[model samples]
Target: MNINLLKLDFKNIRDFRELTIPLFKEKDVNTPFHISLIQMPNGTGKTTAINLLRSIVCGEILEKEIVLSYQPTRYKCDEGYFGVLLIIDRDLYSLGMHFDYRNGVMKYETSRPKEVGGGKSFSYDLPPYIRNVMTKNFTRLFVFDGEFSENILDNKKTEAETSIKFLYFLDRLELLKIKADTLLENKRKSTKDTKVHTQQGLTKLETEEKKLKQTLVDLNKQLKKFKEESVSTSQEIEDLEKKNDELLSENETIQAEFIEFTTKISSLENDIRNGTNIILNILRTPSQFSLKMNDKLKNLSENMSKLKLPRSVSSEFFKELSDEDECICGRPILNDSIKKKILEKAEQYLAADHITTTNCIKGSIRNMDDYKELSNLRDNLYSYINEKQQLIQAKDLLKLRLDEKDQEKAEKIKQEIIRLSSNLVDLNLYIQSLETKNSAFQEEFSLNEYENINLCQKKLIEKRKRLDEASDTVNFSNGVSLFKKMMDNIISSSIDKIKEDLISKSNTRISQLMGNKDVVLEKIEGCIYVDGKKGVSQGQSLAVAYAFLSTLFEDSPHKVPFIVDSPVGSLDLKVRREVSDLIPKLFAQLIVFIISSERNGFVEGIGKYEDVQFLTIYKDERETGSIAFHTDKKFFMQFHSENEEVQV
Candidate 1:
């Protein structure tokens, strides 16, 4: 379950005419070094290498344009190659991608372990478990760049949630549920007529079911469209607002006031976001929201304590009692009848596992005593709302002054802002309607049941159930339904458990890297959210992302390499040192693609570790091929790109 990169080779691909970068030191393939820092100056094929690595692992089907993009510019060549050697769990494997630029075709080949006769296959021949989950989305989790940090925080991207599901094999459980649904549908189809229902009734039910299924499909498509449109509209509004701000700043008379207002507004927004996070956290526990619930929990705890509930008698005790000829009280249990009765009663007692779960629940309920935090959170929420309103009024006043200074341009910008804001509002409302669950008595046109995914799904399930009943496949349908419900519950509970554990571990790492507890990760829905800010700096984002990934992969059965481009380029000196200190211990193999500029503090920090291998790759004088320099720390520290070309 541990995968290490052994070597990466390229031929006629990008700037690399021929290259073999050994990821290990002293030719020790059995135990690769923990860190491999490949210093490639800007545009020397760092991105190409990263992309090819992802494509190889994920078995990505290359587009025509992408295939041609890999052709080297140095010479005329119709073919190119990129290959990676990997050691997975002590087994050697190599994956190669053959590119034919003339035909815009890319073919993959993999070599198996020596035990399997060591033959090459013209396909991705990864182990079953690894291949099953090595999706493009999952591969991007480890084989990524600095932009991954920002992507993990975007609300519209499900990278965070999808990674968790895939890593934990929750997606597999979902697939099982889908299989169960398929089985039920097949059973319904096979049973066309039942003892109680005629063929006509069954046919009518089937028609209705088909209609409902189609309705669900259409509703889902509409939902996806709305969600996508919402993201684009939000971006448009943000861009327009930035343009307006720039326009306002151009006027000398209002520039100073505008800058002051912008700062204050930004600060207030952060405050509001933080306050909302705190309130949401406090509200998660219902006892904190109501004094009555708190009292009830307290009373339950007291009663359980008085009654000696979760009694000392365990199933094991009963089991032992039944096994003995005489009872613990010295009663004569030589009779077979007595032993049988005792054995029968054993099932009524709590088992060890149940007792442990009960104790955990009791402890949680016993600890719910304070409601003051909720009251304070409510007050803070109100304060933030009032402050936001004040900031809005101040911004409006500033806009008024700008309008007087330059009416024509100001009015144009103002009108555009107004229009975009209105559109954004409508988009948000529509998104909400699609997500909302409609009640039976709700007006049809206000929010149609078919328009909402939740409601439409409910209707589909009901129709399917009726069809199953009419077709006399009730037993199979019920079994499948129960199985689906069990899977759904497990998925939900697993997500919650993993999220809690990940948040705790990630926050600890974040605190260490940031040197304080100022940055708190409040939740992980589609992405990671900080306690009081809408956005974090690039450095913080990277730190947060690495912390999250490290925690996620800590206990995974598969230990994969972490390949990154410019791992510490965006961070400051202090953060770079912290990251360098923390990242090496988190992964089994770390491959970093860096430029000379990032070597100041980061290289020194990680270079202190003896297990690091440093190498530099740069373009040759003619810019036709790349040159690789295998160097020690001294040389790596002194090396800088002489090519005056700007880094992309």
Candidate 2:
């Protein structure tokens, strides 16, 4: 499919309102597939016409909806493609593109919501014909302002590539390979991390396991020594009992005589018996002592008793005073001796061997009496009287056991511990060496597992070699021609001819882009540069650039209509005549914007040529809008006659 016609359907388009704007005159079948025009006013929608042409070819403005005098193929290129013309304005206002084509459909979806903060914009859904042709090719052609000359060229490359990518060039081989190469680099990094992490974990595990096994071996040796030393302590205890027996025999003889004397009155009397013995014997005599003396001995015995007392302070006070004084409630005793009487009563019920005696008893006390019974009535007492010596022997043997029985065992345990510890140190060092060996083995094993790394490295080296070879023009014809082909895709051979033909024709028509400065159409390398090495003024630059672009479309692949707004405002007298004649001869269809000031020159130029049409723009008063009309010789003549009457 290709575009057949372009309809200018803006919110307020005056001349083209619902017009099936045929791109060519009805009878001009052999018209050139190009156009040229000159605009005589400054802000007269000259650039707008170019942008609308691009929008139409892009299927932004649907072709089928508009009339076509000649059907434009909607899907295929009638000619190869279209190009852009860049007018330098800091605000980018003068930028414009023009496209020519036909056929099928290309579709696009974009939405600009009615957002609040930014300038409102509307969008068009492109047809598939546009998407197919635009997405694949014909995207790189451009013209630059050429003010900074080389810089503009460089900057345009970037902008052109950006537009192509946004147009979906990445679906093609070039951008696809770029994405794949990025993924390949990421995969290489991931594989490297995986190998490093696995190797690190494996090395740590092997080292720790080796250390643990060596610790277990050292513990086994320690257990062996612990068993042997603990078994020898029993023998040392047996020797202690034998030394106690001999001392026991000598103590029994002396103890027998003492027991015999204890039984006889005179014999026992000659001895200062244990005070306990004397008191107990005296008490057995009974009636000889008064209650006072008996009480004194009882008191002495209780005082001397080794029984532990309760730790209560009230208990101690009650013990000394009995519950005898004041009835314990602070009331005076009815009888003055009542405290003494309560004491006598508590003493009567006192624990046995608590000698607060109301009566005396002989050989009958609590724990003191139990001590004597333990002696077996002096039989074993005498037998064990030198028991201290026996005890000393047993104690000395225990001392020997402390120093010798467990001592030899402990010393052997110490030696065995030392030997085992020394063995452990050697084992530990060996284990360390083994651990180091394991780490080395694991490191080697891991390295072997990732042998692909080496392969990849080798592959990368090979790739670099290939890329280097391919990238060098000396090595490959394709590489040598890569830049040339890229340029060809960017601009067709027709554009180059445009330079020669348009500049040549322009020099013929406009006497070159200078006044009395003899100039020639020159090619510098592949590009056309003006003969003036020094730069021209902004006006001359504009004139030349416009001529350059107009000439570029002269031999275009298909018929293109030209519409220019303000073209003669900056031109000198000679250049104006040249442009005036140049337009109709060079282009097939031409619509120009003009002011009253340049009308005479334009009329003279139009008269100079045979066929041309000029359109007039007016703000219509009654309609409250703009109106477009054609001005002819009869209308001008009528206006001239009316003005003459008003003057008369």
Error of 1 at 473 (Å): 5.2
lDDT, residue 432, model 2: 35
lDDT of 1 by residue, 1-648 (tens): 788889898988987788998886676766778899999888888999999999899889899899999997767889999999888878889999999999999998999987866889998888787787788877888998867766777888877888899888888898999899888777667664443245576788789789878888887788788788878877887887777778778778778987887888788788878978877776788887778888888888889899777877888888888888789899878888888888789888899888888888899997664874567767877887787688667765666666555666667767887887788788777777777765642345466557777777887787777777776666566677789999999998999999999999888877876677766777899888766254555455556767888889886777899999888765677677766776776677899998888776787779778888888877777555756656676777778876533222
Candidate that would win on lDDT: 1
Model 1 regions lying over 4 Å from their true place: 154-157, 184-469, 473-486, 507-521, 530-541, 626-632, 642-648
* Model 2 lDDT, residue 234, Cα: 28
Instruction: Provide the overall lDDT of each model, using Cα atoms, as 2-decimal numbers.
Output: 0.80, 0.38
lDDT of 2 at 507: 54
Candidate 2, residues 165-238: lDDT per residue as tens digits?
Answer: 33323325454445554654454354442222233444454454454444445544444444343333323332
True-vs-predicted CA distance for residue 40, candidate 1, Å: 1.3
Candidate 1's TM-score reads 0.53
